[model samples]
Target: MAHAPAPKAATAAPVISRMLVHASEFRLNPSRRVVPAGVLIIQVKNIGQDDHDLAVRAANGHILKVTPTLHSGDLGTLRLKLKPGRYWLVCTIPGHEGHGMVRSFTVKKPVKKPARRR
Candidate 1:
């Protein structure tokens, strides 16, 4: 007689985090100031009349990721896996960050749910 096939192992669902960023002439606004550590998808929209781009920087003064230049009314997206720490979103264009085009946000560990009692 033939043996039955092996059962597949169970896996946990992945955690997702999302953020919306608005880029203007002299400012960058985020939808939220905090999120859980996991895969993060950031949607950047250029709401100003000038071309702009977004750069993700860590608290250690290192640039993590950057998006392509976006013209007025343009949109771009950036996907990253972030850990529990603080990050900054800024426009790398000349004189942009100095002109108030920067924002700081935080990420925390995901909260674990309590197990059900029988």
Candidate 2:
């Protein structure tokens, strides 16, 4: 009789990275920014005493909605896979955006090849 080989073990998938953005005073701290092109994890913390939302718009007029509404002291998270491009981040709470609660940012593509040797 012949002996059997051992079975291989399965591996778990890696977790997607995230970016934290706090919502307060109708503004986002570190307003202007950039992220790597891939899965994006948005952590929204509503510090105001009212409901707020995290709305995003792409350069091509496409809308990528994050949190619809978050109550005071509440937290909302959105996981989205995005491509490299410019996007607008805003809190669509009445005159929030108009009150300087909106900001623009970009998603840069990760560098592929390393520098060539001399």
Candidate 3:
């Protein structure tokens, strides 16, 4: 009997942005503030000794996705397929946002390629 072809493994999305939170600090630092419109993967590293999470929201305050709470030294990732626009990233850990744990990001429209002539 002939066997069927094996399935291929899924590929990981490109990590566009990276963030880190230090222990005892009420801040969330992102490596990039701008990204090209498409599948976005934000990798957050919890280098601090505290629990932290990430939230992505639209300009109108509509939440898109939230990652689970990451413990100290834990790595959490947030994946979003977004359009070109402005967005906000906040850490809703009680008073974390109030303590300046929020950041704004923008998704730029993809540039069109030029046409080629024969």
Candidate 4:
């Protein structure tokens, strides 16, 4: 009988990209203002006493993604696949956006590695 080959070992652990935001009565604070192009896991903590939500808009002023309304002191998460450009985060609740519950983030292009010489 032929011997079976051993399974290949993992070279490295897959990176878990994440972001944090604090949602209050009138503002959204993002931990990062810029990130590279890829999928990002966003976590939000509602620090205010009112219900709030998080929405992301494209550079052209169109909403791309949004999370459900979370109660006060609740934690929420949103996963977004970002491309190279700018994006805005806002709350869509009545009078929320008007009250300046908005923020911005930028996605930079991924750099290519140099080719190896023969």
Best by TM-score: 1
How many clashes show up per model?
0, 0, 1, 0
Task: Note the Cα lDDT for every prediction shown.
Answer: 0.94, 0.78, 0.77, 0.88
Residue 14, model 1: Cα distance from true site in angstroms: 1.7
- CA deviation > 4 Å runs, candidate 2: 1-15, 30-32, 113-118
Which model, 1 or 4, shows the larger TM-score? 1
Of the two candidates 2 and 4, the one with more favorable lDDT, higher being better, is 4
TM-score, model 3 to reference? 0.77
Tens-place lDDT per residue, model 2, 7-49, is 8788644335577778887787533388877787788888887
Model 4, span 1-118: residue lDDT tens: 9889998987744334688999997999999998878888889999999999998899899988788899998898988888889999999898999999999898887666688999
The TM-score that candidate 2 achieves is 0.76
TM-score of each: 0.92, 0.76, 0.77, 0.80
What clash pairs does model 1 have? Answer: none
Q: Candidate 1: where is the Cα deviation over 4 Å?
A: 1-5
At residue 10, give the lDDT of candidate 3: 92
